[model samples]
Target: MNLSMPIDAVTMLLMTQAIALVAALVLAAEWRLAKVRSLAWWSAGFATIVVGSGMSVLRTADSFLLYVWLANGLLVVAHLLFAKGAAAFAGRRLPGIWLGVLLVWVALLGTDPASDRTALFGLVNSALVAILSLKAASLLLSLRRTSEVRDAVRLGHIFLGHGIFYLAKSGLIFMPGLFVSLVGFKGLLIKASLYEGILVEVSLALLMLAAVRHRRERQITALAERDSLTGAYNRRAFEAKAAAGMALARRAGQPVALLLCDVDHFKAVNDGFGHATGDRLLSALAGILTDCVPADALVARLGGDEFAVLLFGLPPENLPALGRRICHRFAQSGAGVAGASLQVSTSIGAAASITGTEELPHLFDRADRALYDAKRKGRDRMSVESGVDLSVATPPLRLAKVARRA
Candidate 1:
């Protein structure tokens, strides 16, 4: 828990600069692998800060001392890059007003004719850095709110703390003694800011790495959970979602429904129009199923020419209407795809657990039976099965059938 390392006062700034360089390198390497533009912006920002700090260190050399304001300007630019990185991460445009911030700094520099303009602009520089850091924090927090990227929340907090620190540092200029004690070295050429800077750099580097890792993990999970051809939930994901959805609905005392949908004469379509056309049609069917169902519903492709929909919190009475819409929309979509010469449509079998007591497997079995019933009655239609009556010890295996034309 002792985060501190052995430090030499004279070399503290150099240590901070070294840490920033390493963070920049590591982030740049991650950018190469992940190809996230935000990482590139963050890395460049870190590198720019290091360059500015390095330039300030050169102030001991009499010739370089006069341009310390230049170093300060670069520090401000580094904060700008940090803000831009956050904007890119959140998919937002750069806040153009911040350019006015840099212009303000430039104007302050020209107003002062001192040999060391850094001393003159010290308060201004701190204020600008604080403003930029706060902007970055706000943008990062928005990323968390909008994208559900949990790591962005942590990064936002870190930047928020950094911004507040700089704001306090700017105010400390009024009390030179206290300012020196806080950010200045103990009678050494380096600064106390160096100590804090090293810690900040380390934190930023680790958290940004975690952010990119989190993104890559989500991408991998999506690939595994989705069907590549139809972009719907795969069989594995569908099974998982069905079990969980039923459990949640049962506990909430809400009804759940299952709709088993199969393409009518799918084999014939494949034979007549070729497999490529059939694949396109299957993809189109997935879209139709998604459009017809509620946003919370799960649409999955169980296998070739067959798909399933899991609905929760829906009344049993509405299931038939949804099935009819899906069937009808798919038939229309199919006709447009390969022309009206080929008759194409879908058959759906729907079953509902009105009492929220039936298990997923039982519901699936009932739905499968209704689906076949639809095919038997006629293709391009929807068939509804009787709802489960949990109060009955022996519920009827099969009951009423309502067939709706597509």
Candidate 2:
């Protein structure tokens, strides 16, 4: 393909348009994923595609090398941003000054390349490429740690492949300059054209690959955070959100309540009936829990019979009623415990956050103690522990924020 293709005005226009379209799509996706640090890296690449292509369309060899240099400058920024995005996605952060250096490189690239600026630009570009290669290598190394190897491998493929492509392009662009100084312009034009052709095709292919990888990564993440059985937030996800809710409540000086419950003697039913029956019972329980909870509340099965509820922004006055309603609904559930005439009952322990003094963990601890106390006092009853109005002595709210760092 490179052998036959001719470089002309039409080729340049088409290339510009193609780059812009792809970049725009990537940018849109990144905007959607602004909250996700990993996606941010892809977004940076998309931005670079746009800027670099624009520069190529506007500048020629005869034109001021400034524009061409600027394009190279944007390429560096794009890679740096992508590296940062990758690190962010990998749950790490790189030094900020690297990005600062990239910005400075862009400024330098905008200057006339005929001046002393060329040497500086060359040094910066080399450094940028080296850093990008290292970053890509790091991402590949981290791939094994990811739970979903397929998706991580896909991302690694992108980083590894693109890292090589960019490195090749850097070599191709710089090699001709070196050769021209040594062997003269005799072979430079032909050699440069060959390299450019390879660069363009490989880059386009890699961009498409990256787009696919990005979508797959999102899906993989969604699957990881989601419960496979119940299609709700899994334990890890629930804990994360619960902690965030606690932080928000503390910041806003509002109350947060948690309700922990379990299917009354669920094991005996599973033992008496088959596993399928137990699954159905659990599914039925999930449905009931989903139906009764407020839209703002979070519900999760901690495992087996144990379930959790995080009620954000609810006042203490309303929490007891909520607890009562939950208890009442569970009591009314028709599925009786195995070989029992009485319906299955949930022993619930509810705890609400106290203003100014009570921490998130303490609230959970108190609620848990209250639950233990409830089971001790009698099964199938709702226990409310208000850390504030301890007219009811629920174990000192000895809860730690679910995922909050001490």
Candidate 3:
């Protein structure tokens, strides 16, 4: 078999093969460690592209139907899979209608007039590719906004560029006389397409790998910084975040409030019931803190039934109210738990920075003293400390309505 082919055809063949190889390598990486589902779909898409391009290169003049069905069908399926992969990456499910569209396209290819009109086939293929590419790009761009990984944004831009390129290629086909002239020239249009395709393939492959890496790194970081039980930040993370928040507050001339809360009778709950029940109480309390605090506030578990909250831009007067809200919410939540006999209560100590010059440790110490005072004078109450600035007023410590034990 003579392997010699037109330069443009050879280039397309090589580009498709290269893309397939890259996708395979990415899939292999996914299998070994990452196990990303989207990579597998992308690999399948690249494989189909390789098969389609190969068929286009090898098809003879007599095999018109075979060429139309295999070449065009594979390319369309490849784009569909690419779209599916993008949806998977964005954690979205593609609609069933997309699969139906592909089925209809294959059915049209089998029809009498549709398969015979090569120019019409080209136009439809271009339109399908443009649509799928644009859809994939939109999904990626939307994901970029909420994603912490920077590579996701880069991948979005790449997908957007690829979509725009295909849209331009499709639009050129509708131009008067230009499509015919381009089709008449054997190598020109194909060469341009192959060049752009190769660039897009290389860029997308690299960016996809980077995106996966960034996401994995973020997951690892979260595991390290967060408490495994409650999904709250651990002690170390809490201190680091508190320091950063205090620094920001100082610069903005805003007050930062710290609340140190300890479960009132955690040991009693464990002794009366079991550790599991105590764990449930702590988890419930964490949920209450999350719900009661503002979105900008940082809530963390500082180990062993103690939780911390850092609130920025809140005045000293508001600390008492926030603390009460947390206690009230936790008490309300405790009433609804399965073990009604096990009463859960919290003692919270709040300290607010008036001068914006106080360090996190000193502020924490003040809150800890206040928390001790709350614990000493019965549980289920909040103690507010008016630090350094004597001008700042402190609200009276009041106990909220306690949840009844069965």
Candidate 4:
């Protein structure tokens, strides 16, 4: 049997296979680097595309069912896996019902005894691709809301464009006179579709790599800014964030407050228990401070048992109350470590900016002095400094509590 093929059709077949090879190589690299599961799924999807398109290229006059049923089915599965990969990248689950839909389509194709299966195959394959691509686009777009990845929006747009292309291709099948024939290898429309598919496949693979790179960059930055033990911001990150917050607050004429807290008798806890227990206690206290503060507050572990909180737009008058709350919450919730009923508490010194221009070190020093006063009075107490400058005698706001062993 003689088989006639368009030049563009052959080109499309070669390009699809090349795309599969590139995707597989990318998957291997990603697995070696981070073992990212999404890349694996996408690579599998591209391989399926290659197999399906290869089958299409090999189809002869006697092999109509091969192109109509098996090849088209593979393409549907490929798009479904692409959607699954996008869902995985976005940290979500794709519905199992989609897989069932593909299975049902394949079963229906087998049962149908239609003389011309061209339109049916086109409709089913294009519809599935459209749905899956749109779903992938939606998942990627949703990730943009919470992720700091810079390429999230770009990837989402790419997926969205692919979805729109498939949707238009599907709609063209239903419209009369849009194509010269229903055969995928013939007509100017088929050539256009082939070119568009090549572009989408290549661009999608590249953009997916870009998105992964962006996520890795964000992870690296987060690790640098975060403390290894407590998962809170490190002292350097805290100072940088606090400085920016203070500058913004000054510009907006909003008050900024700093709370310096020291875990009283932390050394005793280390001495009594092991250093591991002391670390657990610090982690527990970090959680408590995080929970007690407002959402906008910047909390950090400022080395050893000391922690810092930077509150923006909060009134200076509220500083004392915030300090008391931190101390009370830490004493109540952070008292025990790892089921051990060891008593623990925090001493907090709070200072608020009279003017936003006050240096972070100066404000921290004032809060440190107040923290010193709290330690002097008792372990489980709070002290508030009224002025940024030490020249003004700010009476310490004291919480009465019995002194504990250090």
TM-score of each: 0.82, 0.44, 0.87, 0.87
- Model 4 gets an lDDT of 0.75
lDDT of 1 by residue, 226-267 (tens): 999999999999999888888888899998888888777787
Superposed on all Cα atoms, model 4 deviates from the true structure by an RMSD in Å of: 5.2
The lDDT of each candidate is: 0.76, 0.59, 0.73, 0.75
Give lDDT for model 1: 0.76
lDDT of 3: 0.73
Q: Candidate 1 vs candidate 2: which has greater lDDT?
A: 1
Q: How many backbone overlaps does candidate 1 show?
A: 0
Q: Compare the candidates by lDDT and give the number of the best one.
A: 1
TM-score of 1: 0.82
Write candidate 4's Cα lDDT for 1-406 as tens digits.
1123355577677788788778867866885788777887888888898888888777765777776478777877888888888888898889887778677676655645656666666766777888888998999899767844757668788879888887888788756644444344765456676777778888888887888777888899999999999999998998888878888888887777888887778777677666897898788888888987788899999899989988887777766566666666665553455342566677778887866667888888888888887777655767777532221122332222333446
Better of 1 and 2 by TM-score: 1
With candidate 4 superimposed using the best TM-score fit, by how many Å does residue 126's alpha carbon deviate from the native?
0.8
**Candidate 4 segments exceeding 4 Å error:** 1-7, 111-114, 179-184, 334-340, 387-406
